[model samples]
Structure formats: C-alpha cells, structure tokens
Target: MTIHLANRVETLTPSTTLAITAKAKELKAQGMDVIGLGAGEPDFNTPSNIIEAAYRSMNEGKTKYTPAGGLPELKQAIVTKLKNDQGLEYAPSEIIVGNGAKHILYTLFQVLLNPKDEVIIPTPYWVSYPEQVKLAEGVPVFVEGKEQQDFKITPEQLEKAITPNTKAFILNSPSNPTGMLYTKDELTALGEICLKHQVLIVSDEIYEKLIYGDNTHTTIAEISQELKEITILINGVSKSHSMTGWRIGYAAGDKKLIAAMTDLASHSTSNPTTTSQFGAIEAYNGPQTAVETMKTAFEERLNIIYPKLISIPGVKCKKPQGAFYLFPNVKEAATLTGYESVDQFVAGLLEEALVAVVPGSGFGSPDNIRLSYATSLENLEEAIKRIHTFVQNKTK
Candidate 1:
C-alpha cells in the first residue's frame, strides 16, 4: 500500500517569499551574485537596550515558561505602549501574546472559523490571509482594489462583498505588498459599513509604527465606540523594534474573544520565549528613539526607490505611504518581448539581472510584482540599476 498524506498538507502552497528565497539560495550556491528583494523584514540589528534586557533576563535565570497569555510585565508594557503611541486602551487581561503576528492570526482563524465560514479579505492582501483562512476550513472572499483607487477598496466594494456568512474582514493599514493605508475618512466609511453588517474586524496593525509622512495609523476600534467592540487589533514589536527574531506579537479585543484566543494558545504553543518577553518589555517600555531612527531610514529609502522604479520602462508604481515594499504594476511588462505573466517577468528578471522579487499573484493580484527595499543603500542602488537595465533590454 502507498502512504497517504493529509489533504490539508497537500493543498497548502509554500509561502511565496520563502520559496523565492530558497530559489535565490539555490542560484547563489551555483556561484551567482543574487540581490534578494523578496524579504519582508528589517535589515537592522535589534536595538542594544532591548538586547541588554534579554541578557539581563538570561543572567537572572528567567529561562522558564511564562503565562500562556504572556508575562504580566510584558503585557503591562504593551498596554503602556499602545496607550501612548496609538491612543488605544487595553488592560493586560484583554491581550494575548503569541510567537508572532502571523501565529496569533493563524490561531484566531482556527478558533473562530468553522467549515465554509467566510472571511472578507481586501486584495491585494497579505499572502498569508487567504492561506490561513483556507487551512481553517474557511472561505476567503476578495474585494479588488484598483490602481486608480491607490489599491484600497472603497466602502461600496466592501458592502457588496459581504453576505450573511461573512465572519470577519482582515484589515491591514500600511498594508504589506501594497503599502496602502486607509485615511481617517476612509476608515470611517469602512467602519460604518462593517458596523451595519455586524461583521468583525481583524485589524492587523503590525506596520503601525512604520507609516510614512502624515499618514496617521488609526485602529477601527478608535473610529467609533460601537465599532470598537467588534475589532481585534493585532500588533507587535517585530517591525517596530527590529526584533523579528524575538517573535513577540499580541491581539487586543473583547474579553471573551481574548479569552478564547488565550485558551487556544494555552493548548498550543503554551507560551512565547521567556527571555524574548523580557526583551519585548524593554522594546515597549524603553526609549522609542531607535524606532524613529529606523522609520527615518525606511522613508529615506522609499524616497530614493520610488522614483527609480517609475522611471524604468513599462513600470508604473505609486509611492507607498508605509511599509518597505514597492508593488509596481508590470502590465506594460507584457508588452515587452518574451514576457507574459508577472511571474515570468519576475523569473526572467531574476535570471537576467540576478535580483529576486515576488510576483503579485501570491497577493491575489496579477500584473504586478513586489520589490522589498529593506536592505542597505548600496544594495538598493545596485538593484535599481540592474532592474532598469533589465527592463531596457527586454523592451529594446
């Protein structure tokens, strides 16, 4: 008899960024000089203060399990940070810490979604939203956003997509892939729609601190008092503090939902790493100068890369309000010789210029590609030059 694999395992696809990274690694093994532009992380070191806190914790023998929800000290720190930075109020009991934002999102999907339950996700969404929804035996309903609209769905589109079975909508501002943030007026519009339909809002605010310019990051909970009751706000110290390796993220919401997530976490991962929790405490409670410094760097890089990307032939991109990615519409890339889908465009560019980028198909859109500018200035300049060269060659 042949061995059988689980259907769920068979159906799930590999994360696009990880898959591209692996391919880039394979090419590098063959002695190719690859410039990787597919990563979704800060290329900065963890701040020294936070690192010292972790060291102190380890020296003090804090290498034990914490509460499933989180260490009280860390939770309290998060409370203070949220109140100070985002103007959101939450007690420690209303929060649950997880390995990362993605982990908590997956756990929430599992806990809340039943078979055939619907999740309304705005496209182009974070790559994990639809996949996680599928893994939980739930359906993802995508509402498309066009380039004319800054790739953000409007209230009309959102309302038309909702149905009686819609359980939640995954809302990300300073959104990944697109970097499109909803303005206060836009959130008010969406908030009212969700309120009338009785739909829950899973507001992913991981990129909250990284927003660019005058773009204020608003939580749906703060839009109005009534909407606050139905919003589950997910945030973390990863992007904010360059602590991606520390793996601390959290969710804030109604006590019952928080309790359910806490229960799910208890049976699953049990607790996050202990020393990392100490580090996270410092990340929240410590001086926020490092966060500002990193944001400054990102904004500088964005200013540099956006114009360069748009200058290339057949490439049209809008300046992102937040996040470290540029999603350039490569539809004109098809008009060039030997390029068909966005995937082929990216693969060809990688093979020719040795720059690894992710195709937008993974984010529920075609005709676009994502380039992560989360690297050094030297690397960014070289990558942009190579992309320009590749596009010129393809067109000519």
Candidate 2:
C-alpha cells in the first residue's frame, strides 16, 4: 500500500544544525574522535538549585497537570522577571508558557497566520523560523542583513519588505547564527516602522542573558507603551539557566493572542512538563549566580577563540557582541581549500578533520559557517587548531 503524508510535512526541511550534530555523534559512537561545534545549547549542566526544585516538586507529588498556559506561580515568576530585568510589565493573563521557546514560537505562528499571509524574516535567521512559518501555511519573506552591518537588517529593508499581506515580522536579537545584537536606537527605528505599518513584531529574546562585554540586551517591547502593545516577546530558561532539557518557555503579548495560543496548546501539549514548570519557577525567582557564571565562561571562550578563527587563512569574522556562536565568512576559505561551496568545505572538515560545524546555507547565508563556542576553552582551542590545520593542508 502507498501511504500518503500531509503536504506540510513534505515541505518542511529538517534542521541542518541537528543533522550535523547527529552525524558527529554517529561517528563518535563508532569510536571516532569527533569534536562537534554544531550544537546550540550550553555545554554546562542545569544549576543545582533548579534541579533541586524539580526534585522537590516531584517528591511533593506536584507531577500532575497544571493550567494549559502554565502554573500561576510560574506565570507570576515570569511576570516578576520581566518587570525586574526588562522593565516590562505584564499580567499573567497576557503570558502563555509552552514546552520550550521553539514550541512557543511554533504555536505563535499557528495562531497568528492565515494562509498566504507573509512573515518577514531577516536572513541568517534561526533555522527553524522559515520552516515553522511554512508549516503554518504562511509565506516567509527574506531580507538580507549585510555582513558589514554585523548581520543586522535595517529600517529601510524592513520597509521594503512590507506588503498588504505582511502579517508579522520576526526580530531575533543576539541572533542565533550571527550573534549580533541590535542597539536601542536601531530597535526604536525598526519599531517605528512596524507601528506605522501596523505589522505585529515577534521578538525572540531567548539569548538575552548571554551577552558579552560592553554589550547589553534590549527588549523592543520596552521601547514604548505603544510598541509593547504591538509586540510578542519570547523567552525561556533553556539558554540562560542551561536548562535546555527542562523545556520551559513563555510568551507575553496581547491577551487575545495569548488566549488563542493557550487554547491551541491545551488541545496539543495540554501543558508544559509539571516538574519543568516548578524548576523554571525557581529559575526565574532564585539567585542568579549560576546564570552569571555561565555567561562569564562563554565570554572568556569567545575572547580566546575568535581571534584564532579570524587568523586562519581566507577566513574573516566580526567579533560577536552576544550569544556563543561565531559566524565567519568562509567563502574564500572554501575556494582556497579547493571546495566549490561552503557546504562542501564543511563536509570536508567533518569527514577529514573530525570537526563538526553547521553550514551557513541553512541560515540563508551560503558563504559563511556558524561555530558555537559553548564548550570548554580547551575544546575550543583544539577545534580551532584542527580547523586551521585542515584549511592550510587542503590549500597547500
């Protein structure tokens, strides 16, 4: 019998980041020494305080379901965190917690988009954004962020992309592949355009707490009361608390939007993990010493490895202001190494040098490659050394 699947599933592209990580693991399972730089999560473990919270919750039999959106305590904790950190205020009714930031975003797209409605996504975006929009039956309009501008789109570009069918625009600061952050003035300029056009802004701030030296994270919704009303702010504990597996993320926006998302989640996920919610409650309210520790470590790694990566022949990169990834333009490196494309060069690096980094084509930048520096200083140094040697040998 020939079985047919949904057209949506057929059109979706699997995540290239996960694909590389899996291939590296497959080699390692066969006793090959593979060093993977493809993973997006922190290498650190979840803090003891957060873990203890989950254990306590389970011991107290808090394993049953909570409200579909989230537990009231967790929602209040998120509310408090937003107020204290971002200076943004939200009632619990305006926030909806889901399985993770990714899940929250998927739900947001589903509820906000109608068929053929367009979502403007800047290039070098997170790999999942366009795919999720397509899954929701929405079109994704791409706007390239020039490399010289630190891979950030401009207000002019935003204005050009808007059409009558443009429903929402995604803003991922301290962005996934590039690690570039938007300053306050830049965000205000973009916000004005969105407000003037009456387009919704979806701000993904999952990496807000991971900024490096002299760089700060700003939430666009906090720019003004009016912009706040037109924005949906997305965040979670996965990156900040090194709690990727805990899977707790929340969104705050208009009450009607939140309610719709909650309704859809109730039928789909029912609720986020009960133990994870308790853990996240503590993540938000507990002392933030662990978060600071992880941030410091990532910054230290970046300072150590970024210069070495740039020194490699034919490779150039701007120092990332935030996040733990370095997206280096490797087009010249690909040519020097005798490969026709960045993807081919990356494949050679993985198969020959046993170093795994994500190809940039998945992020809509085919001339670059993203290397995550979330691992130890020692591992980072080793990976760079291996990459340098591979490029030199291939070029010779």
Candidate 3:
C-alpha cells in the first residue's frame, strides 16, 4: 500500500550533520575507534543545581501541565534574563516558551509566515532554519557570509537580498557551523537596512554565553527600541547551561506575534515539559559558577587543538570567537587528498581516518567542513591527529 505523506514531509530533509554522527556511531558499534566531532551540544552534564531543581519540582508534585506559552514564573525568569543581559524588557505577554530554541523558531515561522513569504537566511546557517521555513510554506533566501570576512555577512549583502516578499532576516550571532559573531557596529548596519525595508529580524542567540576572548554578544534588539520592536530574540538553556535534554527555549518579541505562536503551540506541544521548566527557571535564576566552568574547559580545548588543526596541509580555519564548532574551508585539503569534493572527503575521513565531522554543504557551504569541539580535550586532540595524518598520508 502506498501512503501519501504531506508535502512538508517531502520538503523537510533530515540533518546532514546528524547523518555523519549516526554513521560514526554505526562504525563505533562495529568496534572501530571513531572520534566523532559532529556534536551540536556541550559534552558536559546538566548542572547539578538545575537537575536538583527539576528533581525537586517533580518530587514536590509540580508535574502537571502549565500554560501553553510557558509557566508565568518561567516567563518572568526569561524577562529578567533579557533585562539583565541585553537591557531589553519584555512583558510576559511578549514572551513564548517552547520545547527548545529550534521549536520556538519553528513555531515563530508557523505563526508569522504566509505562503511565498521570504526569510533572508545567512549561509552557512544552522541546518534546521531553511527546512523550518519551507515547512511553514515560506521561501528561504540565502546571502553568503564569505570566509574572507570571517563568515559574517555585510549590510550591503543583506539590503540586496530584500524584496517586497521579504518578511524576516535571521541573525545567528556566533553562528552555528561557522561560529562567527557579528559585532555591534555590524549589527547596527544590518538593523538599519531592516528598518528601512520594514523587514523583521530573527535573532538566534543560542550561543550568547559561550563567547571566548574579548568577544561579547550583542542582540540586535539591544541596539535601540526600534530594533527591539522589529527583532524576535530566540535563546534557551540548551547550550548556555548544558541542558539540551531539558528542552526549554523561548522567544521575545511583539505581544501579538507571541500570542499567535502561543495559540499555535497550544495546538502543538501544549506546553514545555513541566519539570524542565522548573529546571530552566533555576538555570536563569541560580548561581553563575557551573556555566563558567564548562565554558572555561571549552576555551582550553580550543586553544590546545586549534594550532594542530591548522597545521594540516591546505587547511585554514578561523579561530572561533564563540560557539563550539570550527568550520574550516577544506577544498584545498580535499583536492590534495585526492577527493572530488568536500562531501567525499568527509566520507573518507569516516571510512579511512575513523574521524567524523560534518561537511559544510549541509550548512550551504560546499568547500568547508564543521568540527564540533564540544567533546573532551582528549577526543578533540585524537580527532585532529587522525585528520592531520589522513591528509598527510593521502598527499604522499
């Protein structure tokens, strides 16, 4: 019997990054010593305080469903977080909490977009952004953030992409896949363009807390009140606090848009998990110690591993200012290693080197690859060593 699936099912493809990770797991199950660098989350456990809060909540019988948008208390916590961090204030009505940052984005698109509406997505993007736009019957317009400019798109590129159909522009600071951040001046330039065109801004700041060195995160909303009104800021505990399994994410924007997403979410997820919301409350309201500890460890590993990674023949990577991934342009490396494209080179890494990394084609960049350093120092070192040797051997 043939089953007819919805068109979205055909349009929304699976994640290529996850594909590499799954294949690496398959080889590892067969007893190969594979060091997978495709992780999208931190390797650390959820902080004990947060886990204890959730456990305490469930034990205290706070296990029932709360508001569909989110528990009011959780919304207040998010409001406080924004005020403290970005100086952007939001009423509870202007906030909506969903299962995760991804879920919040998916819901935002569902409520905000009509068929044929276009969202300007900067490449290389998080894998789900374009797919979610398609699922919502929206078109995704791509603007490249070239490697020469540290993978950050220029205001000129953004203005050129907007048309009458353009509805929103996604700004992922410390962007996934590339791990590059947009400075305040750069964001202001982009925001001015959005203002002139009346296009919305979707600021995905999931990695705001992971910045290294002197780099600081600036949400577009923070630049001015007008930008704040035009921006929907998305963030959650998944990365900042290593609570990926907690599945709590929220967005702050105009109340009307928030209400629409809340109504849509009521029909969809109903609410974020009861206990997880409790944990998220603690994540924002609790101590700052554990978050710093995990970030420090990631920086140490990056400092240690980056030089070795660049030592590989024909490989060039910008040291990431934030986020856990290192996206390197490997076209030269792939050619020197006798592969036709970066995709085949990625496969060769898994099959021959037993080191797994995501090909950048997944994020809309064909000549590069993304390696997540969200693993142990030991694991990252071993993976880089394997890749370096693989390129050297193939070149010989």
Candidate 4:
C-alpha cells in the first residue's frame, strides 16, 4: 500500500545538529573515538536541588496531569523570574507553560498565524524556526545578517523585509548558531521598526543566563510598554539550569494569545509533565549557584579554545558574547582542503578525524560551521587538535 503523508511533514528537514550527533554516536558505537561538538545541550547534570524537588513531587504524589497550561505555583514562579531577571512584569493569566521552549514556539506559531502569513527570521537561525513556521502554514522570509555585522541583522534591514503579509519577527538573542547578542540600543531600534509596522515580536531568550564578559542579555519587550504588548517572551530552565530533561518552558505575552496557546496545548499535549513542572519551579526559585558555575565553565572553555580555532589557517570567527557555540567561517579552509563546501569538510572531519561539528548550511550560513564548547576542556582541546590536523593534512 502506498501511504501518503501531509506535505508539511514531507517537506521538513531533520535537525542537522541532531543528525551530526547521531552519526558521531554511530561511529563511537563501532569503537571509534568520536568527539561530538554538534549537540547544543550542556554536558552538566541537573542541579541537585531541582532533582530533589522532582523526587519530592513524585513522592508526594504530584505525578499527574497538571493544569493544561501549568501549575499556578510554576506560573507564579515564572512571573517572579521575569520581573527579577528582565524587569518585565506579567500576570499569570498571560503565561502558558508547555513541554519546552521548542513546544511553546511551535504552539505559538499555530495560534498566531493564518495560512500564508509571513514570519521574518534572521539568519543564521536555529534549525527549527523555518520548519515550525512552515508547519503552521506560514511563509518564512529570511534576512541574512552579514558575517561582518557579528551575525546580527540591522534595523534598516528589518524594515525592508516587512510586507503586508508579515505577521511576526522571530528574534533569538545570544543566537543559537552564532551565539551573538543584541545590545539594548540594537534591540530598541529593531523594536521601533516592529512597532511601526505592527508586527508581533517573538523573543527567544533561552540562553539569557549563559552570557560572558561585558556582554549582557536584554529582552526586547523590556524596551517599552508598547513593545511589551506586541512581544511574546519565550524562555525555559533547560539552558539556564541544565534542566533539559525536565521538559518545562513558558511564554508570556498578550492574554488572548496565551489563552489560544493554552487551548491548543490542552488538546495536543494536555499539560507539561507534572513532576517536571515542580522541578522547574525549584529551578527558578532555588539558589542559582549551579547556573553561575556552569556559565563560568563555558566561558573558561571559550577563552581557551577560541584562539586555537582561529589560529588554524583559513579560519575566521567572531568571539561569541553568549551561549556555548562557536560559529566559524570555514569557506577558505574548505577551498584550501579541496572540498566543495563546508558540509563536505564537516563530513570528512567526522569520518576521518572522528570529530563532529554541524555545518552551517542548515543555519543559513553555507560558508561556516558551528562547534559547541559545552563539553569539558579536555574533550574540546582534543577535538580542536583533530580538526587542525585534518585541515592541515587535507590542504597538503
């Protein structure tokens, strides 16, 4: 029998980061020493306090369906977190918790978009953005952020991308592939354009707590009251507290939109995991020492490995201000190494050198590749050495 699938499902591309990581695992399973830098997850364990909270929740018989959106306690905690961290206040009614930040975003697109509505996504973007918009029957308009601009799109560029069909602009600061952040002034300028054009802003701040050096994370919604009304702030404990498995994330914005998302989630997922919600509550409300420790470790790793990466011939990288990924332009390296593209170079590194890095083609930067420093300094050093050797030998 010939089975047919929806066109949306047929057209979706598998996540490149996951694909590379899985390939690395397959090689490792065959006894090759694969050093994978493709995973975006932190190598750290969940903080003990959060774990204990989940245990307590399970022991106390809290492992059941929660409110379709989230528990009041969890929602209130999120409200407090937003106020304390970003100085943005929100009522509980305006928030809805989903399985993770990814889920929240997927649901948001479904609720906010109509068929043929357009979303402006700046590249290089998280791999899922364009796919998610397409799943909701929305068109993704890509605006390339030039490499020289630290991979951040300018306000003028944003203004030119807007069309009558444009519904929202997706902003991921301390962006996933590039790890670059937008300054307060930069965000304000962008927000002004969005306001003038009456486009909704979806600000994904999952990496807010992982910043380094003098750079800071700012929410575009915090720029002004008007912007806040049009902005949907998406965040989660996964990146900040190493609670990826906990599966809890929330969104805050217009109450009507929140209600729609909540309704959609009710039928699709019902609610986030009960115990995970409790864990996330503790993650937000408990001591944050572990989060800071993880951030410091990532920063130290970046300090040690970034220079080594750039020291290789035909490589150039902008020092990332936040997040744990290093996106380096390797077009010259690819050309020198006799490869036709960055993807070929990355595949050769994995197959021969036993190192895994994601090619930037999926992130909309075909000339670059993304390496994650979320692993230990020892593994990172070895991976860099392997990459350097591979590049040199290929060139020779």
Candidate 5:
C-alpha cells in the first residue's frame, strides 16, 4: 500500500519561478537560446571585500556553530547599519539571523501565528507569503489592487479586510513581482491602520536598496515608536551585496519574539554558517560603494527598458519607482493572441520568442506578466525586440 504525504504537504505549492527556471534549463539543454527573466537573483558578483572576509574566516577556522541567534559581532554590525541607514535602533539581543530572508520570514510565521489565525496580504504579493502562512496553519486574506493604482492597497482596503482573527499584515516595499513601492505617506497611513487594529506588520525589505529614481524606501518601524514593538523588520545582505549564496539574513524586532525565533532556529537549522556570518559583518560594515554601483546599473537598465516595454502594443507598464522588475498588464496580449490566461501567454512567448517571463497569476494576479530587467543591457534589448515580434505576430 502507498503511504500518503502528511497533511501539511497538501497546503504547499511549488515555487513558480523555480519551475520556470527549470523549464528554461530544459530548453537550453535541447539547444534553445533561452533568455531567462524568471530568476530572482542579481547578475552581479559578490563584492571582493566580502569574499575576502569569508576567506579569512575559513583560514582562521571559524567553521563551528556559535550562538543560534548569530555571532555577536555580526549582530552589532547589523545594529549599526540599521541605525545609520534607516534611523532605527536595534540591539543585538533583538536580532536573529537565519539562512536567508525567506527563512527569517518563515520563522516569524511559525512563531507568531497559530492555527486559523489570519494574515492580510496585498495581491500581486511575493509568491511565498501565502504559502508560508498556510504552512503555519494560518489563513491568508488577500486584498486585490488593480493596475490603475500602481498595485498598492489603500488604508481603507486594509481596514475592510480586518476581522477578529486577523493577526498580521505582510508589507513589502519595492515589492516582488509587481515592483510597486508604497510612498512614505502611504506607509504611514498603513501603519496607522495597523496600529488601530493592533495587527503586527511583517515588513519584507529585501529589495530595500534596489530602488530607482527619486523613490525612497522606508520601514514601518521608523513610522512610529509604538509600532517598533509590533513590527518585524526583515532584511539581509543577499540582494544588496550580491551575497545570495552566503546564506545569512537577520530580523530585528521585539525582544521576546526575537528570542523565540532564535530558540526555534537553535532546535532546527542551528546557527547560520560561521564563515558566512563573518562575511555578512563585512557586508554591513565595509564600504557602501558596491551597493550604490549596483543600484546605478539597475536604474540605468530600468530607464532603458521601461519605455521600450510600454511601446510594445497591448503591453501596459508604469515605471516602477524601485526594484528590477517590470510588471506589465498583458491581458490585451492574451485577448489578441487567443491565450486564455497569463500563463498561456507566457508559455507562448517562451516557445516562440525563446524568452522566459513570469506570469502574474503566481503572485495572486491573472492577466498580467512580470519581466525582470536584471540582466545585461544587450540581453534586455534583444528580449524586448523578440517580445515585440511575438506581440505583432499574435495580432496578425
């Protein structure tokens, strides 16, 4: 007899970007020239200084596990970075480092949410938020934001979605999938709503440093002193320092919650890699030049690509204030091409144009698609040309 998987397994959905990346790899193996916009990673290398620090840690033999919360020095560096960059103060005791920002978020859900507790997530969210809430036996309540409002949920929308069981709201600025960021006034409004409802805010600021033009990223914790105790500030070195493989991310929040998360980490993954922790120290303490340089490149690419994408008939995209993604409303493309959904549109684009773009349905929206401008300028130019070709022919 076959044994069934656990009930928790039933609640999980596979990562859509990973699935698309695998398909792209399969096509490449079959001799196709696949341009993948599906990857969520930067195309840049980790900074030399950070790498050197990691090497030094290895030579100095820092391979063993330390405190599960994180190395003290690493936490101190994070504290300094938070205070200097964001005007937020967090002590080492209130910080917990995990394998990645994703893991830190999952730990928060596990620690704070009980079965049937409700989480408010804005639509066009990062794909992982809903699934993680479900894994913790919590329910996800989605608030839909259309293309007209820059994909941002209003404070009124937040108030309407609240229920007796609502426990937290997932807030991501310069958001994944949509690349939509809430302005400072907008965030303050949201913070006020959450404060009134006594709902915790899980602020995912992973792409905090990758914004463009005049757009500034702000933290909910910085909005008010009272909200500081209620907000979980999640960030890491991966996106900004090109240190994704380093497996180091940390959260700053209420001391009790931080301690619980660290206890959970101790019994589970233990301390994040020791060498990586040292590397993360340098990432936070060293020169900020690498991050600025990467931001400059991203901004240049955004300026070059956003206008080009809007010029493609049937594709509608606003210039994202930040982040490397361009989420275009391709519903018209689907209607003209006879594809019933965004997934089908993406499949057709991949098969015909040899380009990979993510369908927005994965992020809780349909009839739209996400294009990541994280690759080189030459690649971006060619991919858009191919997309233009595909769209023109579909019209015919």
Candidate 6:
C-alpha cells in the first residue's frame, strides 16, 4: 500500500543537523568516542526553584488543561517580565502562550499568511524560519546578510527587498548561528523602513538573556510607539532560564493577531503543558542568581575557546556578543585540506577527527560551519584541538 503525504510535507527540507548527528551516534555505538558541537540549548539543568514550583503545582491539582492561550498567572508573569526588563507594557489579552517559541512562530505564520504572501528572511537564518513560511503556503524571500557585515543585513538591502507582497520581516538579534547583535541605531534605521512600508516585524528574541561583554539586548518594539505597534515579539524560558524541556514560550503584539493565534491553537495544541507553565511562572518571578551564573559560565567558555577556534589555519570568526554558537568561515581550511566544500570538511571532521559540526549550508551559507560551545570547556578544547591538528596534518 502506498500512502502519500501532503504537498506541504513534500516541499519541506529536513533539518540539516540530523545527518552529522546521526553519523556521530553510529560511531559512538561502534565504540568510537565522538564530540558533538551542534547543541542549541544550554548545558545547565533547569534551575531548582522552577522544578520545585512545577512539582508543587502538579501536587496542588494544577495538572489539568489551562486556557487555550495559557494560564492567567503565566501570562501575567510574562507581562510583568516585559515591563521590568524592557519597560514595554502589554495586556494579558495581547499575549498568547504556546508550547514553545517554535510552535508560536508556526502558529503565527498560519494565522497571518495567505498563499502568496511574502516573509523577508535574512540569510544565515535559523533553519526553521523559511520552512515554516512555506508550510503556511507563504513565500520566503531571502536577502543575504553578508559575512563581511557581521552577517547582518543593512537597511538599504531591506528596503530593496520589500515588495507589495511583503508581509513581515524576521529579526533575530544575537542570531542563532552567528551570535551577532543589531545595535540600537541599526535597529532604529530598520524600524523606520518597516514603518514606512507597513511590514510587520517578527522579533525572535529567544536568546535575549545570554548576552556578554557589555552588549545589551533590545527589542525593536521598544524603539518607539510606532515600531511597538508593528512588531510581534517572540520569547520563551527555553534559553533564558535553561528551561528548554519545560516548553513555555509566548508572543506579544496586537490583540487581534494574538486572538487569531489562540483560536488556531485551541483546535490544535489546546494549551501549553500545565506544569511547564507553572515552572515558567517561577522562572520569571523567581530569583535572579542562577540565570546570571549560567550566563557567566557561557561567556567564560566563549572567551577561552574562541581564540583557539580562530587560531586554526584558514578559519575566520567574528567574536559573538551573545548566544552559545560560533559561526566560522572554514572554506579556506577546506580548500587547503583538499576538501571540495564546507560540507565535506564537516563530514571529514566527524569521521576522521571524531568531532561533529553543522555545515553552514544548513543555515543558507555554504562557506562556513557552526560549532556550539554549550558543552563543557574541556570538550570544546579537545574538539578545537582535534580540528586544528586535522587541518595542519592535511596541509602537511
């Protein structure tokens, strides 16, 4: 019997990290040691207080279904967080809590896009953005954020890409693969363009709390009242409090858009996990100690390992201001080592050097690769050492 899938599923590209990760698993199963540098989450456990709060909630008979949008307390917690952190105010009615930021984005596209509507996605993007747009029967128009420009697209390029079909623009500060941030002035310039053209701004600030070295996180919505009215901001506890598994994320914007998203979620997800919402409540309203500790550890690891990573022959990296990943152009190393492409270089590292990395092709940039520093400093050091030796030996 043959079972056909939907056209949307047919058009989808599978996640790019799976191939290298699968091969790494096979090698480990065969008794070969492998170091994986593709993690997108923090290495720390969820803070103790959050866990206790969830347990308390479940024991207190709070394990049932929550409102489709989310619990009032959780919504209020997010509302309060935005006020305290950004001085931006939002009513509970303007927010929708979903299973995760990814799901929230998926739902947002579904509600907002028509078949030919266009979403302007800057290249070297998080893998899911374009795919989600396509699944919603929308078009993804990509403008390259050139490596020379710290992988950020400029206001001129953005304005050029806008067309009558343009519906929204995605801005991921401290971007996933490249940990570069948009300065306040750059954001304001971009915001002005969006205002003139009437394109919605989708600000994915999931990595908001992990900034380092005097860099600060700013939502474009805070630039002014006009920008605030046009931006739909996405955030979650996944990165901020090391609560990836807890699955709590929210979106804030105009009440009508949120209401539409909530209606869609009601039929599909019903609600975010009840226990996780309670845990998220504690994550926001709880102590600040653990969050800072985790941030400090990540920054320390970045400081120690970044220099070593860039020291390898033919590799160039821009020091990241936030997020846990390092995106480096390894094309020169690949050519010097007799490999044809960065993808081949990544596979060679995994197979021969016992280190796994994600090729930049996955993120729409083929000349580079992304290595995460979310593991222990020891593992990161060993992996860098292995890469350095492999490159040197191949050239020798």
Quote the lDDT for 193 in model 2: 99
- Could you report the Cα RMSD, in angstroms, for every candidate shown? 1.1, 0.7, 0.8, 0.7, 0.9, 0.7
Candidate 1 residue lDDT tens string, 1-396: 999997766778778888889999999999999999998999999999999999999999999999999999988988888788667788898889999999989989988999989999999889999989999999999999888899999999999999989999889998899888989899999999999999999999999889898887887788777888889999898988999888999998888888898899999998988999999999988898999999999999999878888888888997899988999998786567467678888888788899999999888888888988889878888998998888887784
- Residue by residue across 1-396, what tens digits does model 5's lDDT show? 999998977979898888788888999999999998886878899999999999999998888988998999999999999999889988899999999999999998999999999999999989999999999999999998777988999999999999999999999997888888888899899999999999999999999999877778888899889888789999999888888888888899999999999999999898898999999999999998999999999899999888888898888887788878988999887777778877998999898899999888899988788888889999999999999989888884
Write the number of the candidate with greater TM-score, choosing between 4 and 5.
4
- The digit string of per-residue lDDT tens for model 2 on 1-396 reads 999999999999988998898889999998988999987999999999999999999999999989999999999999999999989999999999999999999999999999999999999999999999999999999999999988999999999999999999999998999999999999999999999999999999999999988888899999999999999999999999999998999999999999999999999999999999999999999999999999999998999898899999999998999988999999999999999999999999999999999999999999999999988788889999999999999894
After superposition of all CA atoms, the RMSD between model 6 and the true structure is: 0.7
Query: Which residue pairs show collisions in model 1?
Result: none
Indicate the TM-score of model 6.
0.99
> What lDDT is obtained when candidate 4 is compared to the true structure?
0.95
User: Lowest lDDT 10-mer window, candidate 1?
Assistant: 333-342
Error in Å for residue 196 of model 6: 0.5
Tens digits of per-residue lDDT for model 6, 96-175: 99999999999999999999999999989999999999999999999999999999999999999999999999999989
User: After TM-score superposition, what is the CA distance of residue 87 in candidate 3 from its true location, in Å?
Assistant: 1.1
lDDT of each: 0.89, 0.95, 0.94, 0.95, 0.90, 0.95
| TM-score of every candidate relative to the true structure | 0.98, 0.99, 0.99, 0.99, 0.98, 0.99
lDDT of 4 by residue, 36-77 (tens): 898788999999999999999999999888899999999999
Task: Give the RMSD in angstroms, all C-alphas superposed, for model 5.
Answer: 0.9
